[model samples]
Target: MEDGKLTVRAVERALDILLCFTDSSDLSLTEIASRVSLHKSTVHRLLASLEGKGFVIRDASSDKYRLGFRIWELSANMTHSDDPALILLPEMERLRDQLDETISLYVSDGLERVRVQAVQSNQAIRRVAPIGARMPLHVGASSKILVAFAEPEVQQSLLASPAWPAGLDKASFRQQLAEAKSLGFATSVEEREPGAAAVAVPILNRAHRLVAALAVSGPSNRLTLEKMMEHAPVLMEAARRMGKMIK
Candidate 1:
């Protein structure tokens, strides 16, 4: 492939626009310009070119533009296919049943944690979050464990963000992350979502790198903070045992 100089400004604005699509469904020209810190006309021109190239689509009714389905198609093809989801689901189910709570497995995706597998408890009252849900690293027990065990670069990127989006303040998040790493387990009390509490521990490979996080979650009333701490050891052991069995 031949290499040539690309317009840095154009490239930067394009990335800014693309990043805006992560959490937002649709954005107007003004909103995109403000978020990207580019002039309205400049953003409009870029959006027009991107739309022509099938990378961005405009909603006529709302007069807003967003990432096109082309991005989804590309991303779906790029997701991990060799991970332990298939090999670990049954074990996760057993753990969930034994504990009478939800068990989930997550892996680091950049600074975020993505749920790859889950097993819901048979209890009538249980929390159920599906697979493929991406969560903030600072919030839930599973996500925090993933962040605590991540490589230094991954942790640094999350900490360096201007606004931590997991409903956690920077200082509090840092404190929890440090404690979790030292303790080899993570517990959260109503941090990720309302009325939910969880405990999790990292699954490490033979090389001591994090492969996944094993977590149990339930309603805050049923899974009190005290009970979560008590159950931490159980979850930690399960994660370790599964890690050894898996890749």
Candidate 2:
């Protein structure tokens, strides 16, 4: 092969090794070599290069390789420019029109969640969450949904901080998050703002990682607990559709 083609082949082989770990957390050298259809020595060289770059790590006890923290670091940087609001705006509009309630998209930002986009309700009385508004992750439905589906490390860090919402201890907050994850959605009534209620569902990427939260909010009188539950399916369906559109 030409020099350029040889370089491309090498890159492809390296990527093939990385992809092998997707279905399983850890793999032995022989397993990787077989999966990639490469010689054991070639696989060893590629694995060493990947380990040096912090893309994979070997377990000293088991002699198996697994993804390294650098993969998450790269994913974090990707999120910086990933604005799911652009993809979710149309779905938000559809939800707003269907329910005549305010629809908002929120993404995790440290211990807080930021409202990236919103479609307002035409009703005379409705909850209005301004775009760019930041709220505590432990409070509103949208914020809590973002927190509930956050990476385990991120979730633990946020829960340990003083940013935990008032009136709920760490244990209680953890239970709530567990419940949210179990139900595949979250609800809030006067948690963030008096007389405001909301229900939110997580928008996940193809990897099943949280990308954003889709929520509908309105006055407590209009969005009572029962009403919110009734509308939960709509919000979840919209979230599912949004997830497919986002990267």
Candidate 3:
């Protein structure tokens, strides 16, 4: 066979291995080899390549293979009119009208939180997050939710940063993260910007891995912590819907 065809065959086989995990969360080398109908050695080789690219994760304890965060990252990068942003904008618009606030989607990038999408409130005074703007992961409702639900190693790395906000107690912050995870949503009052406040919820894929944080932001007086907590359910439901469509 030609060299190009050989490479194409390798690509197909690798993709097959990745697809096998859709039916099950974790698989062993023999299990994957059987599912893909390839030899164990070939499956192992493909999995190694996938692992190198962060496409798969091998648990040290169970010696099992599972999809990794890289898969979630690529899936979230899709763009089109009415895209991930589109899929959530209608719901966001409804939220904006109801709360008269800015609705946004935030995703973690390294140790930073980035605003990937947003729907602005029509009110003369409203919160806005420009697409691609980077915000401190430890500073706001959406930012905190993104970091709080992140994988443990990621959370540790973020918490250990020297840039942690002055005067904010780490112990109290840990308590807040615990509460947000327990309650399924988080709220902030002028934590990042003066006169600004927001509430956010985690968006998770079928694998239960966090995809992004969905948020509502506005002037602190209008988007009181109480009001945001009250709307938490609706935001959570919206997040649930958005997450279902991911991968």
Candidate 4:
């Protein structure tokens, strides 16, 4: 067989070994080799590779292997909304206290944006993006910011989607998304709710992937264009701090 074909066959066998643990978490080297119909020597080498990369660990006493911390970490982050909110809430509060405005953190759920964390302003009339609030991705500063910072394939699929607001101009929306990304922030005045204004920035992960949108919103009279622009830098910085805190 060609070297490339041998490599592919080896990978397939390695993956088969991994799948054996799906139904059972722990297995001996002999047991795994039997399950995958592979020789003991090849199975041992594959298990060593998996263990070296922290995908699996072999117990010296029991002579059995089980999944490792890397697998747990990946599973935990599969639901991005959970652990990240816990880490980001404190930073959101700090930004709210610093700016004296409503703070919100939203993550994309398919074509909709879900508010996972928020700190409402104590003022008499403030815009409230309540926790668990779900909004379409085609409108609002936070929504636009989330979609704009989304992965390229995701952004293209979302933009080409037909669920956008009626009479929405795709070209202008694309231009606005580009501007928002270039400027590192996005703003909307009375777009989502009447008498409401907001400025949003992207909350990214360690890989620089957009996980959420951090926004400060308030009554239009108080959060005017100039104020949102002035506070954009602060919001951007807060998002950066929150991203660093995400494990």
Off by over 4 Å in 1: 1-82, 165-168
Model 2: pairs clashing at backbone N, Cα or C within 3 Å = none
Q: lDDT score, residue 58, model 3?
A: 99
lDDT by residue (1-247, candidate 4, tens digit) is: 6999999988898788877875576999999989998889989999999899898999999999998887888877675654777778778888888999999989999888888888988787777665767788888899889988998876787777877666888898899899988999999998877898999999887889888899999999999999999999999888888888775
TM-score of 3: 0.64
- For model 4, the local distance difference test gives 0.86
Q: Which 10-residue window in model 4 sums to the lowest lDDT?
A: 75-84
List the candidate numbers ranked by TM-score, top first: 1, 4, 2, 3
> Which rank order by lDDT, best down to worst?
2, 4, 3, 1
Deviation in angstroms for 10 in model 2?
A: 48
Candidate 3 structure lDDT? 0.85
lDDT of 1 by residue, 36-130 (tens): 88899989989988888788999999999988977888877764645678677878888887889999888888767888888987888898868
Number of colliding residue pairs in each model: 0, 0, 2, 0
Cα-based TM-score, every candidate: 0.66, 0.66, 0.64, 0.66
Q: Give lDDT tens digits, candidate 3, residues 1-247.
A: 6999999999999998987865578999999999889999889999999999999999989999999989999978866643566666777788778767789988888888878788888888888667767777877888779878999988898789887778878888888898889999999897787999889999998789988899988899988878887889988888887788876
Better of 1 and 4 by lDDT: 4
Off by more than 4 A, model 2: 1-82, 165-167
